[model samples]
Target: MNYDTVRSVDPAVADALEAEVDRQGDTLAMIASENHVSEAVLEAQSSVLTNKYAEGYPGSRYYGGCEHADTVEQLAIDRAKELWGAEYVNVQPHSGSQANMAVYTAMLEPGDKILSLDLTHGGHLSHGHPKNFAGQVYEVENYEVDEESGRIDFDEVRAHAEEFDPDMIVSGFSAYPREVQWEEFQAIADDVDAYHLSDIAHITGLVAAGVHESPVGVADFVTGSTHKTIRAGRGGIVMADEEYGDAIDSAIIPGTQGGPLMHNIAGKAVGFQEALQPHFEEYAEQTLKNAQALADHLQDHGFSLVSGGTDNHLVLVDLRDSHPNVTGKEAEEALEDVGIVLNANTVPGETRSPFVASGIRAGTPALTTRGFDEDACETVGHCIAEVIDNPDDEDVKAEVAEIVTGLCEEFPLYDDDTEGLVFE
Candidate 1:
């Protein structure tokens, strides 16, 4: 991928852009929240639509020359509805957090109470972490996973909701490995008379492919990122029954965001179309298989996994048990040095600072996109175990790096002849 056009205009930015593509091509991206969008999706995002500002939804735009914007946005909304079987879909909000913000803005007033999963127990910052807007505006309480089982206990969540009497209840999570029981959360919300907002940000693609349970018809509202498992580029979407459609639209447009990212919506359209193909389901199923394979391989090497394993695309390894002296940060750095990239995450019963948490979260989405199967994931898992087991061993790192280079070559990201944005 050559960046000749960019180099002609700005050589420095061009070099950085080219270097990034090289880095992605060379490393294994195991971050649970990341995936590689198709080249088609990338091109759509880099389109001229970025120049246009469509201030309103589809037909009722507040700006002129929105014909193309309307077409792309409508296609994105329609495709999202088809993918998730939602009665209404909004493909706007800049990110999953903003999508959650729109829902909160539409349904609750300031000081309204929100009940959600605890952050360290697999929740997101937008659900009401102290540093985020939701936390500042709403009175929030959190429920946690059972430390013994490393899974959410619905009874505990119900009890927390009853005690908190929150106006809204959030379901779905970030670091959790088990399948979320959408019905259980919906029931809890019903019992408490609270609005249920299920944020399926990390598993949007899995849900679309029917590999994971969907929250669309079960919850009062559903929000997801267009990237992550979906590979739709960087954006967010909100879905609901038609009853709340107008409120959601208004909240997103006048309340949270202004003009929609029309280019990103185009990417969403293309990616959603790609997902609709039959191969996407095969991809989703393989993603789960690969995660399980990695989990088993890690366990074989004596790593303790949260929930004992994974039912989804990610597995969270608690370093405290297997390697008491190793922090998740140290494991992350060591693995990155050998080209296996993931993240340090806080575990269910975390005792250390979030930055130096005792667990690592790894996933199979991007690797699966790069054509990795169960066997390939196990190979990567073995490499991860080796690096973490002997983080200070230079010979081990060299061996792992060589294996990573071989794997990267075996599963090339882009064609050799593909020009534009190529790094040296």
Candidate 2:
């Protein structure tokens, strides 16, 4: 686990790497889909396991001398099963999108209808976006969130399911702030005889820590990312009921990716172990609290929040009514100038394009992981509101930047005091 390489072969690349770390240390990352992984996870990700080429599963590899690789991969599998209470786990897909692709390939035929949430309405690209492979292969029918409530209308979803009669029903979101009703989706799937697949990539950490509802028992297949709120390396996992274990594993191995990244699997094992600890529950709870606090603060400051608030770690601010002059692009740029990082996102009935959305999505997972709490979240929210309210005001942006820097200092991401903490 040699994590001490400071210089790159190219001086320009080395400078960029160092600069990126400084940027991360100084900026307030409000991106809902990002988080700071622990040192233990980082060590595993940069470990010697990168040298291995173990193409197959444990004890059944096509290559030789994979004793340690087998141990690491199996550990990830076992821990994921334990964490999610799934009958089987496949920690091989390169990303959450790939995991979902494998699941689709394993069960559905080309041109088979699939019901998923619309991408602009809080769904992911892998969930049948026209440009994604899922849409190219399957006939995708999309359900949308209610415009008034900004929440999923189960009745609407059920109506779509009944009409579409999809082979699979995909449930998950990348920007949705409310809780997903898994049982409702499951019942709808049952009625349509569709397989229920829950992509919990964004909320796996909360589900693992028991802060959010688990979709494992209800969904036939569950796909998640190792990063995001899980605070692991960049990788994907697919967990399924016992009946689909063989098919899902085969789909991931032969149908989608060729070889697995053993190093990331090792990191996933460490992340799962951390998630199993009781303190991880505290972390998940704090993440939710910080999100709610930020949402309330923004609302109090006269910013209209989509869905009115958040039940999870992210919030979507509808700038259409709050700051009609400020586009999502302008707000994001203004926040970036002040060292606050968040992505521009589309609202439920967005009139603007995806690239230039009508809303900004913000979250507290990364900052909370860095030790920022409810009070800090409120301050951060105020900073964001100030920037959006006065995007052209350089003085206001400077003030917010100073405040964000002060908050970062208070909540150091990597403390020097615990430099060598290892996982047993």
Model 2 lDDT per residue over 328-366, tens place: 998999999999999999999999999999999998889
User: Which pairs of residues collide in model 2?
Assistant: none
Structural similarity to truth (TM-score) of each candidate:
0.98, 0.97
Write model 1 residue lDDT over 315-389, tens digit each, in one string. 999999899999999999999999999999999889999999999999999999989999999999999999999
- Cα deviation at 118, candidate 2, in Å, is 0.5
State the TM-score for model 2: 0.97
Error of 2 at 277 (Å): 1.3
Regions more than 4 Å wrong, model 1: 418-424
Give the range of the ten consecutive residues with the poorest summed lDDT in model 1. Answer: 415-424
Model 1 earns a TM-score of 0.98
* Candidate 2: C-alpha lDDT: 0.89
